[model samples]
Target: MTIAVSTIIRPSRILTALVSAVAIMVASIGLAILAGRIGTLGLTPRVLTGFGALFLAFFGFYHGVRIRKILQLDIAGAGQIRLSEQREKRTCSDSDWPHVGKDMQVMQLMPGSTIWPCMLLLRLRAEDHAVRVVPILPDSVSRESFRALAVAVRWLAWQSDSQESSYL
Candidate 1:
């Protein structure tokens, strides 16, 4: 007899969005500085650089805010993996989130025992997927969910009739 337990992996999109906003703000400020310096070349250069910097700032902020509303990570139980729009079909994959999630798939998500809030790697046995290295996001996911995910993975491993298992 075999019982299947379900685990939902949903890191807060709100949190990621917030981080992205910060990045956008920093980049915008950096671009503004660059424009100010490049303005020394000539009035034409100054106007062009200033316009470009403003465009970058606007584009960055617009995209950053938009992602929060659409970011989706539906990797729950088996066959439940789903990526939202703007995530799958995109030209410039400058946003690291999409690329990061691409390598993940539904599988025996053995997130490891003793998986501290330090590092994590999820691998799929399917022919269509590759290993995804999800680094330590101590605060990206809620503490409880992270622990629960770890427990689920460990439980599956232990139930697989493995003798050399330790999850305490």
Candidate 2:
């Protein structure tokens, strides 16, 4: 058995929102700077740009801190994993997977071994193929969980194969 822990895949909603907010901020700042240089632009443009920049800064700070807090939770670490078995649902499909849990960041579970702190780019062995349980958390999960999840996943895959073969 190769029991392991698994986390959710990357490109999470929180991350998407963060990126979009950042992009808007960048655009607003750029526009503000350009308008200031042109000197012909009205005060309204400057005011609106300044407001946008302010909102971006406020929201960015708020979201960043919130994400950090979520990352600190254990459930968040488990939530980050996306297993091959639950690929269709796209996020922690097995609500009852042993020791498996999820939050805004990580995916937690036990199969055969533990896989923890699995990065969004991290790839681990699955039951039938190699799958990447990308880290959706802004902060990385615990190293221990990451390793455990990997082992458990591999073990589960092995067990599944054996069962299928036996049935045949």
Candidate 3:
């Protein structure tokens, strides 16, 4: 089985939001300064305000880099997730797109579902800290991919059974 590790890229929305926020804040401050609205505090306050904005912008840039650099290894544990056969009609869906290293926050989204859909059972405990996007997108993650991921994680975990793995 070719178990390829998928790398999580920083969400474009995050970068866009951060950049936009910083830009707006800077623009507003610049406008105020241009309007000759400097307070009695003088140049010190302006300098401090500029520093604060710079710090915030730097933080946003660094955060994006951190997100891209973080690497997680999924290792399986002895525990196995159990699914009910009756819940074959229900599909495991998530409220939103899942980040790379986060908890599985999935919900049963099939309407009038008497049982969980069998298609998503392979994803049961397959990925570590990986949430399913099936809820948001019907085919974001494939069943075969999930199953292979599970098997790979379990194997890797077993190899490092003596010590706690970084990604469990």
Candidate 2 lDDT (Cα, 0 to 1): 0.45
- Sorted by TM-score (best first), the order is 1, 2, 3
lDDT of 1: 0.46
Which window of 10 residues has the lowest lDDT sum in candidate 3? Answer: 106-115
Model 3, 1-168: lDDT tens digits are: 434433111124444555667766665665565444745546767667656655665676565444432112222233222212121222332332122233322222122211233222223223335432211011323455445444554454454453445556
Model 1: which residue pairs collide?
A: none
Q: Return the candidate ranking by lDDT, descending.
A: 1, 2, 3
Q: What is the lDDT of residue 116 in candidate 2?
A: 36
> Over 4 Å off in model 1, which ranges?
1-39, 70-80, 83-140, 148-168
**Which pairs of residues clash in candidate 3, taking residues 3 or more apart in a chain or in different chains?**
76-153, 87-115, 87-116, 90-116, 90-117, 93-135, 94-135
Candidate 1 residue lDDT tens string, 60-165: 6676455343223334333233333233423322244233355444444334433555433444333455543333244544465456545554555555445445
Q: Relative to the unseen true structure, what is the Cα RMSD of model 2?
A: 11.6
Best by TM-score: 1
For model 2, what is the error of residue 17's alpha carbon versus the real structure, in angstroms, after optimal superposition? 17
> Whole-model lDDT for model 3 versus the true structure?
0.38
lDDT of 2 by residue, 1-168 (tens): 323244433334565566667867666675665468534557887666666766776677565554332222122222333333232323323374443334222233333333334433333443445443344443333355455544555454555568779998
Error of 3 at 40 (Å): 5.5
Task: Give the Å error, residue 33, model 2.
Answer: 3.6
